[model samples]
Target: MRPTVTPCEDFNAEEDAKALKKAFKGFGTDEDAVIEIITKRSNEQRREIATVYKTMYGKDLVKDLRSELRGHFEDVIVALMLEPVEFQAKELHRAVSGLGTDELSIVEILGVHDNDEVVAISNAYEGLYQTSLESDIKGDTSGTLKRLLVGLSTGRRDESCDVNEEAAVKDAQALLQAGELLFAGTEESVFNSVLCQRARCQLRLIFDAYNNLVGHPIEKAIKNEFSGTVKDALLQLIECVRDRTSYLATRLHDSMAGIGTDDRTLIRIVVSRSEKDLEDIKEVYYEKYGKSLAERIADEEEVPSDVKKVLMQLLL
Candidate 1:
């Protein structure tokens, strides 16, 4: 189900004027209360609060937030105020612009987002940031990372298109020639042009054929052939077509059970994937570790305790 999109009147201009005044009236800023309301409010609420804050105080909520709170708390609050796509674009921009690209951030966003989100993020990045995300990425990154991000940002994340058998055969041949082809246009292009291009049922047969020819799972082949951002994008495309829940479960497992739990990765996967398959992930999580996914997350220390708690609530 889509998240509730209702406008929250309680957090709008008039109400927020009262709330913000109250928040700032007592003492050296009630930081916890600031988090409590902002984090709990719906996105519409946050946007409304931003408008209210500016009109009421003649200062931006983000600016006020920066002055009031410090560290990741501020990041999360500001992120909440921006529209979701714009927020994601900002995150993408941040991932690439600083000292070095955060490949993990790239992977989490690319892998978990739906195709429409990927396209929207691309458009939003260019329009809002006044620069092409792809160009920025190219300047910042190198090697396979560059290739993969460029391919994904080219706006072909969805595999739900038409399939031509003759084209599929030809593409399949090309993949074979490339020797463990991983690039989206190379192996993935062929698959989409063929298998995923076909009707869903027919696509299964095509996938079977692909496995027979490759002597490995197509998904596994892509995994082995790609790494970092590109590997993530290809895997997400395949998972979108094949099995969403299993794919998410695998990602969640990789995040927590590895050498270390990547807090950002863990948070992104749980927050984004929860809407699609929380119950299924819970089942898989239990089956895989003989424990609830929530329990595993709770035990992990890297991710913020509050974020873990929020994820647990979302899971439940």
Candidate 2:
């Protein structure tokens, strides 16, 4: 899947910096200019323009955006300006730091990203927050969820492409013994160990083997066995492996399905996926929801007008 936002062929960081300065210079901000310039360039180019803006005019681009823009529009622009890992880490930090823990955000982020990307996210999390992501998860969560997240935070998943059928069968048995084969006292450790360590390809084989052993899909078995957030987390991990595009499309739907939209979740998914598989996500969203993602955004009256346009631009 290709990114929606490619590197602009006629990109000029300095000129962009100047244009942005002009937009923010006097009176009311030129909202149209701000949206056009920010959304037109790739994130990397935006970073370059930020650098040139600071060097040329001694003003921070993000700070200026914050000063000029208000509400969700500012949030969208500020999110766009951040490095992807930084933005993700910031989201993770926000998810855990507040009074109420957002368990799904933590699960979704840790589950979806690959090993190297998770490692970078964890490192950035540590750098930004002065604490390990594992420590935070441990402090914020308990029992199975804690163990699962701590395992993921280590970023030690075996990423080898090869699938070992013998091992997969063994893992399948372990999973069955953990939950499906047992009526009481399900083994969370077994679930954690197998799901956290195996490569995605190996996990797929393990899933197939589990289905063979259990005479039903692994997701159904999980639903019968586990409950609550842990269950959702496990199922979501499987979903990510099965079809990440659809997983994200579902996340987008989750963010928007309810009353008074989940702006943070919506923003994070849209901004994060803008440059990676967003096209596929949009296609999946339409295929799944019976309406285009752009249409959904447009219809969300809760979304500010400027922010809606910017999101639609990313879909382009």
Using TM-score, give the best candidate's number: 2
Question: lDDT value for candidate 2?
Answer: 0.89
TM-score of 2: 0.97
* Model 1 regions more than 4 Å off: 2-13, 28-32, 114-116, 157-170, 180-206, 219-241, 258-261, 270-289, 306-316
For residue 81, what is the lDDT in candidate 1? 64
Pull out the clashing pairs in model 1: 163-197
* lDDT tens per residue, model 2, 1-80: 76788888999999999999999877899999988888888889999999999999898999989999999899999999
Q: Write down the worst ten-residue block by lDDT for model 2.
A: 176-185
| Residue pairs in candidate 2 whose N, alpha carbon or C atoms collide under 3 angstroms | none
Clashes of each: 1, 0
lDDT of 1 at 85: 81
> How many angstroms is residue 48 displaced in model 2 relative to the true structure, after the best TM-score fit?
0.7
Expressed as tens digits, the lDDT of each residue in 74-141 for candidate 1 is: 55556656777887787788788768678656655654565678789989999988998889988988
